[model samples]
Target chain A: MGNEAFLAIGIFVFTYGFIIAEKIHRTIVAMIGGALMILFGIVSQHTAIEHIDFNTLGLLIGMMIIVSITAETGLFNFIAILAAKIVKGRPLALLIVFSLITAIGSSFLDNVTTVLLMVPVTFSIARQLKVTPIPFLTSEILMSNIGGTATMIGDPPNIMIGSSVKSLSFMDFISNLAPIIMVIIVVTVLLLLFIYRRQLHTTAEARARITDLDPGSEIVNRRLLIKSLLVLFLTITGFFLHQTLGIETATVALFGAFLLLLLTGENYLERALSKVEWTTIFFFVGLFVLVSGLVETGVITRFAQSVIDLTGGQLLPASFLILWMSAFASAFIDNIPFVATMIPVIQDMGNMGVRNLEPLWWSLALGACLGGNGMLIGASANLIVAGLSGKEGYPITFMKYMKIGLPVMILSIAISSAYIYLRYLL
Target chain B: MEKLFYMVNNELITLTEHRNENDFEFLIHTKTNEAADRLRKLREFFDSDRVYTDILFYARKDHEYQVIVRRDVYVPFVVHLLQLQLLKSVEWRTV
Candidate 1:
């Protein structure tokens, strides 16, 4: 390896090590690592800037703004309250219903944002029913990750993957991953129901309490709610026509966010902008430069060669290896950076005369996304949910989360394995 | 030790807490609104990682309602809630 490669690897290792240590904020770590790369001449400032995926960052920020505004209208709370009433406070039914809502919510909105909105409502219901919120919260986290896998806009990793590969469309993600995601979600819900069956019962009094709740009352601002819903509808429609409109997903989402802000009036502008997760945005900025260094140093090309060698140049073995590797690695590391680094490597593999790269992309997406459910620290969404629950004095311990999360993650990956085999391997 | 009270909606709302930063637990007495709804909505946001609420109990004593609620909120949010006085009480006690 060249001196530049050595320096790149050193910075990458140091940065991710700090991230995994959970001592320093990841954004700061990434930014420091990125700065080191530039200082060490691994990548120039211009090259590093070019490596940053504005599409991914823009899409994330835009959607975050929209979700921030929508959340203020109490739409998520209303949904939770309504779902509670619909299920009559039955714990098992609540789990199933909320999981369905989470999964679907994640399919379109970002999974982290969906979980953020849903966790409070879950806590409220659990408290009302006098039951532990762990089962419901865990199930929602798992379901949201699964649902986020179904659409290109669902997860940050998916957005990175989608934006990296121009030929891959939003519809392509939906068609390829949605069917298998449905199966995984259903199976996950059943597993949760089985695991929590004993604790999934509530008394008549609790059910009565939920029945008394008028979900309509939860909508604090009906005017803003209407406006938010309209813009959300248009944004989703724009996502569907992403290719037809010849516009990026980020542009569409930004348009929707701004339009909603405009119609809702300029009052929300400051709060909405402040609500954007800048740490997450900056983290992406640093990660892009770090990964770009790896690419520039030919590190990704060499890694792809090693993988090809390990698989003996066979497609099925290569596909399974990528899937499993992505799952395992993403279980511990942030899948966004992992996928960002891997995309270029995978493309390098394709450049090395690997035919049929589509399955590999699907495998990466499925493994990275579903793998997030393997542990509390696996995905950003899981961490957010865990943090929220922890603050509510219901901390989901690592062992507790892994006990359920690991098994479900393995099951989902197993199902995805079958789907990949049937859809592409055969 | 001190107790401060304010009357809103014809119900008394009281705040009693230790005068220590470490002590976030506060006692609230009110009858007009549900504690769960109040605390939950105050801490509500789309993607905050530093918000939590605990509404312990509600007991009615001859048309009076008293509930103990705890909140571990983001620093900024403390100000937001204090501004809105979601409880309709600018009066609080540092006991």
Candidate 2:
């Protein structure tokens, strides 16, 4: 390693420390680090530009727009209300049903937004049923993360992974990860039910009240809901055709966003566009460049070699190592940047003659997604749910969340381990 | 009518501005007053219990200014006040 490599490593460490400490805004820290990489000539301006995965950014922004517009239609709330009505205020049944709803919703929509939409309604139902909302809220958070593993568009990390590999399509994700996620979700739901079985009882009056809930009133605008759903359906169809149509996922997503904007009117365009998480998009940009600097300096290659040595050149052990490492690291740090950095290292392993890189990718996806439920601060959806619950006076403390989240996370990863071994190895 | 007040450190510190909802854009000088006086007057304002208020601290200027909202109307109120509202860095604590 040369002085340039040292400089890049120093800057990368500083940026990551600030992000982990959360003293300074992550975007600002990342932007500063990215700029320093350019100033030091570690990565040229043109090289930095090339390093950014615009497909990931475009897909994120486009989906954000679609979700924002769809949010206004009150479709998510309507779905929540419908779930509550189905269970008729049975606390255990309500928990399972709502978790299923959240899982299914998150499999298509972003997990954070799905949880955000579902939480308030969960709280309301809990209030009416006179039960603590912790179990239901916790279940939803875990299920969202679990469900988010099922597709490329389901989670940001999956999107990044999908975009990084040409062979991995949206359909491939659904076909492979979806089945595993379904089994894991069932196991998780069952575990949570066993843990919270005592708290599942509710009053008869509350049950009657839930049955009385009119889900129709939750829809703020019928026409907008119909249109949004139609466009969303079309966008998803486009995703399934990701390879067949020879169109990038980003292009398909952007097309869907534009089509939605046209149908929804340009007047509302500004509002819809404003709702996109620009900070997150920019965070990706900075992270990509920073990781590119490491890759350019051969640091990632060295790390990959060390990992391969640690695994003794065996594919199964390497997959397990990647899976567990991703899970535990992602439990504390933001998995977006963590996964961003890991993708290159994994690819380096592939370049080093590791056959069937697909298993490694699945492990990374499963670990990053499932491990997010290990702590309240692990994922955006967890934090959003915690914040809402806290505001309502049922604060989900870090320790409190981990008490349930950590073990469940461990169990889910264990299930993934077996699944990976059975499906890919042996 | 719009009720105007300034707060710091989780305490309603002063009443430097008062205006109707239409006059919300009119800035008032609350910086010149002593912190204690501001706190005292703010206490007096809330003493009457005229309406429900939710204290919302600006995320950036953490100690600078807090907008008091009646009931849970802070979001829409802030949105309307800012016109082009961006929830970029705002960490809303509904206390």
Q: Pick the candidate with the highest lDDT.
A: 1
Report the lDDT tens digits of candidate 2 across residue range A76-168. 767877777776778888888998998998888789878877776676667657699889999989989998999998898999999999899
Candidate 1 Cα errors over 4 Å, as ranges? B1-51, B56-95
Pairs of colliding residues, candidate 1: none
Off by over 4 Å in 2: B1-95
Residue range with the least summed lDDT across 10 consecutive positions in model 2 chain A: A212-221
Span of 10 residues, lowest total lDDT, candidate 1 chain B = B57-66
- What is the CAPRI rating of model 2's predicted complex? incorrect
State which candidate has the highest DockQ.
Answer: 1
List the candidates' TM-scores in order.
0.86, 0.82
Tell me the lDDT of model 2 at A51.
Answer: 90
**lDDT (tens digit, per residue) of candidate 1 on A1-426:** 799998899899899899888899999999999999999999999999999999999899889988899988979888887887887778888899999999999998889889988887787678767799999999989998999999999998899999888889889999999999999988988888899999877789877877766677567689999999999999988988999889999999999999998998888999999989999999999999999889899898999999899998788998899899999998998887789888998899999999889999999999999999998889988988988888778889999999999999999999999999999999
User: What TM-score would candidate 2 get against the native?
Assistant: 0.82
The number of residue pairs in model 1 that clash at the backbone is 0
Q: What DockQ does each prediction reach against the true complex?
A: 0.15, 0.02
